[model samples]
Target: MDLQAQIEREGFPPGTSVIPLAEPGGQLFRATQDGGTRGLELLLTNEAVRMYGAGPSLALVLSRLRERAERGLPPALAPGVYERQVFVGD
Candidate 1:
């Protein structure tokens, strides 16, 4: 299934944003909250979707989104590939 479909199927929590990166072979997704710039790295796999948010900043992604929603703001981010990490097996 396509990345977007898979994500929709999984039913990511409200206020969560999933942006597919321009890479293949274990596709990476930039998950942001509250239309923020920095997003957590989401690794998609056949079995499950893994989030690589180990630190405090990364952990705040969902929280930030919730705050945005509470304030009646849309949780949308600019559409673009976040190239902070090098894509392997591309």
Candidate 2:
């Protein structure tokens, strides 16, 4: 899948993983992902939030969402994926 195109479709940031965190059926959620990463980085959607279980594809992802929820604000979510180490493989 085309990463940049997908971000455009979802209205996510250009350089970021987590879509802006937001509750389901709510306003536009925003998330941050290290643009440096490659591959199909997952965006924790409401579907992931509803059940909070989705085949362990995003265990660490959910943890970050929890942090956002605790903040009770979208931009308040800290430790955003502004810069981080990532692995790429072929």
Candidate 3:
């Protein structure tokens, strides 16, 4: 999917920024706002270790994250690069 288009449709709060990470053989993204006080590390994968293999769609995840940002909530996950195995099921 086109990540940038999804981000625009997600309507993140003003100043919010989402960027795709250049992780070889993996899909990863980062979202940040308020000068980085609030952020999320999003990893897109169809498999995870010790957990359900599939996670939510990228559009769905972006929508939820946008909702949280609109409500002034911190990211559900801490901001940073993370191993793919760390994420659980959507």
Candidate 4:
């Protein structure tokens, strides 16, 4: 499945925007509910997905993005992975 499809399966709210990256495993997305931006990268073997965000929550995420935007930095940054997901079969 594609990134959008994965997000849909995860049940994120609507109006989310995702941009594909040059790197095959990476993508950038913005949440519509609060304008929070996040980046994710899929690991090899599809065993894991990594995520990073500038802010902790929807509100703070948008705030940080706006600050970055105002300072001429890209809305998304070179962030360290803060989360890792591994799916387990039931």
Candidate 5:
């Protein structure tokens, strides 16, 4: 998907880490900042994450990331000023 592609090409930002606040398989993505100091640990997957857009892999991850980015992820969501998500089932 474009999300992974962008991450692989550019990245989330200067300070962001895509982490799994609650994922079914426990797999996750982490986007960090310089010196590995401050950043956002956005929830990659929660419960039974799905998609209304693309593939099985990028759907939840990208959706949650966008959700967190727009709705303002919780402070503890990540390591610093991270974010959160609504579990796929919840």
Candidate 6:
């Protein structure tokens, strides 16, 4: 299934804005109503904690985004892309 279809299957709230990334592995970013943005990435096989990594499921990511929206937090980073380290933990 595609990202949007998966999200709908996962039952994310209606009108949730998800921007699909051009990269592989179903990566995407969700924008909260409060203007906060979070990048979501799938974990590799057996991987645990890591940078720019989302939770084990899309539901979790939606829940987190909901919380952020309620809190009205500003965007964590600027619009442009930048290089950053991504560490995968066991």
- Say which candidate scores most in TM-score: 3
lDDT digits (tens) for residues 1-90 of candidate 5: 455464544334434555434345434554334433433443434334443322554555655565444444334434444333332433
Could you give the candidate ranking by lDDT, starting with the highest? 3, 1, 5, 6, 2, 4
TM-score of each: 0.40, 0.23, 0.60, 0.26, 0.38, 0.39
Give the better candidate number (3 or 6) by TM-score.
Answer: 3
Output the number of the lDDT-best candidate.
3
Give a tens-digit lDDT track for model 1, residues 3-85. Answer: 45654554456766666654454545566655565345544432222334233322343344334434544333345433233
Error of 3 at 36 (Å): 1.9
Question: Candidate 2: which stretches are off by over 4 Å?
Answer: 1-56, 75-90
By the TM-score metric, which is better: model 2 or model 4? 4
lDDT of every model, 2 decimals: 0.45, 0.37, 0.59, 0.33, 0.44, 0.42
Writing each residue's lDDT as its tens digit, candidate 3 over 32-60 gives 77776667666655443224332245655
lDDT of 4: 0.33
Candidate 4 lDDT tens digits, 1-90: 354454444433344333323334432333321243343322221112322331222223334334433343323343433132222112
Please tell me which model should have the higher TM-score, number 4 or number 5.
Answer: 5
- Please identify model 6 stretches exceeding 4 Å from their true place: 5-16, 22-26, 32-56, 80-89
Model 1 bad stretches (over 4 Å): 24-26, 43-90
lDDT of 2: 0.37
lDDT at position 11, candidate 2: 35
Name the Cα RMSD for model 1: 9.1
